[model samples]
Target chain A: MAYTVEGKGPSHIGIRMSNDAPPSHKEEARAQAEEALFGFWVFLMSDLIIFSMLFATYATMTHALAGGPGPKQLFDIHSAALETIALLLSSFTCGLATLYMRYDGSVKKTLLWFVVTLLLGAVFLSLELHDFIAMAAKGGVPSRSGWLSASWALIGTHGLHVTTGCIWLLIMFAQVAKFGLDPLVQTRFMRLALFWHFLDVVWIGIFSIVYLLGVIS
Target chain B: MSADPRRERRQELHGYIAGLCLALILSAIPFAAVMTGALPRAGIVWTIAIAALCQVMVHFRLFLHIDLSRSHRDDLQLILFSLLIVVLMVGGTLWVLGNQRAMMG
Candidate 1:
């Protein structure tokens, strides 16, 4: 039988066909995972466009402080650095979870790493919220100026994504407990892993462009 | 799939750790440069931008496993295309608005 260039077969789930028995079982799971991953990648790219627009807006309005507080007055680089580290470490842990799932096929190890990732994500979110609250308390709220408005919109959107990701992580825990590491559950986990890493990448952009450059300027 | 599963696992572990280390260092250097005033303002901005771009590539290759390699070309192409759109939109907005600001001034 000839294989498609994309390696996806005729089934809606795109199950791969093979001659070998045991490996074919793995291939069956991989096929479903690949389809899910492709769909999720398209979603991520759209999400990327949204973030890029937000960043562009923030950049344009950076100078529109309206005589209000600026980044030098509001941004605490120490806290931002801490949050960055937390998110980056969480991404690493999420990658490790997927690796464990792929190699050892141990649901326990995968869940453990995922739990660690969730905690790190929570820490990052709390730090971000604390920053927002502190800024608001100082009259640096979104209504203060265009600069503040754009900054809040950009950073807040990212925070909302992290919040959704945390909720998804909880749902994953429940799914694993209920369904184990079946093909469907594994595909969900893989998509969540992509999402978690994608968030980290966005954060890097925010930190460098919004925080670091803001402080310097 | 690998002929030696143990070796493959080891290699995977190393990749994650190396990515983590590089990401940390890349993140820290920009912050340190900014905080310490180790460079001029323009230089610091450039450093942060470059570091962020590099770290993004590292995450793509190591964490997301998206690369230029044959196995991942489709996803890589998708990402590159998205990046092109982003650059056009963002860079265009900034350039136009910046010029408007200058004209207004």
Candidate 2:
């Protein structure tokens, strides 16, 4: 019988060469991420427009006290603390997930971190909704006051973002599971990561300008 | 142990985590005061605003890597441009709308 080492043959030259190893995995991921980054920046700009409008609405009504709890009365630092920590921790974990993908190149580790990130996101959204529900229970509905109305608009917009993000996260998780870090899946994950982190940034601003500042005067 | 030169990205991530912790700590102190009524509401706002500035820097420099590297110079330009527009939109509305409310009252 002729000898064939299975992987070795003149016909297998293109199939097995391990020296230069064409653009490393890190390089490939970075290259693929470039387009995703550009797209995310565009998306961020569009989101900025939406946020600007919400800010305008809130600013228009900040001083309108119409028989409801004002910002200070409504914003509890303890609660905001929890909300902030949840989002911030999620941001860090998301970063870790990306780092794992970048460094470890272990899809399983990346997915694990992604799940942790999603859990943190869930906690943040839960707390925010709970806060909203509590307010409504206390008769701080949007119809009660201009302040409440603006609060509902601004906070509700942010809440809607979280809701959408959470749904999108589950979809991405499913895709990643089915595809196992295919380039397209990786690109999707990258874009989502940018958007997720961007939301945390916006929330930090929101926590500062709306809640923190509100409590002051 | 010292970090390897090849591990610059690791170092960057570590720095971001530390900066984030600092921002979190700074924000938390006034948070404590506000919840306990040890400080006024204005105190909460100012502290958080300052801390937010720190947090913003931390995100840009550490996480996003928007430093002055030649290749990244272009990214910095875009980031700053986006930031300027966002600030204008948010700040302009606050000024115009707040003043309108004051005038109406």
Q: Which candidate achieves the best DockQ against the true structure?
A: 1
What DockQ class does candidate 2 belong to? acceptable
Tens digit of per-residue lDDT, candidate 2, span B1-105: 123433755685686688568757856765666667765556656666677787777766655556787656656677778778878887887788678767886
True contacts kept of 2: 0.40
All models: lDDT? 0.86, 0.70
Clashing pairs in 1: none
Best model number under lDDT = 1
What level of docking quality does candidate 1 show?
high
lDDT of 1 by residue, A61-114 (tens): 989999999999899999999999999999999989988876677888999999
Compute DockQ for each candidate against the true complex: 0.83, 0.45
Poorest lDDT segment (10 consecutive residues) of candidate 1 chain A: A11-20
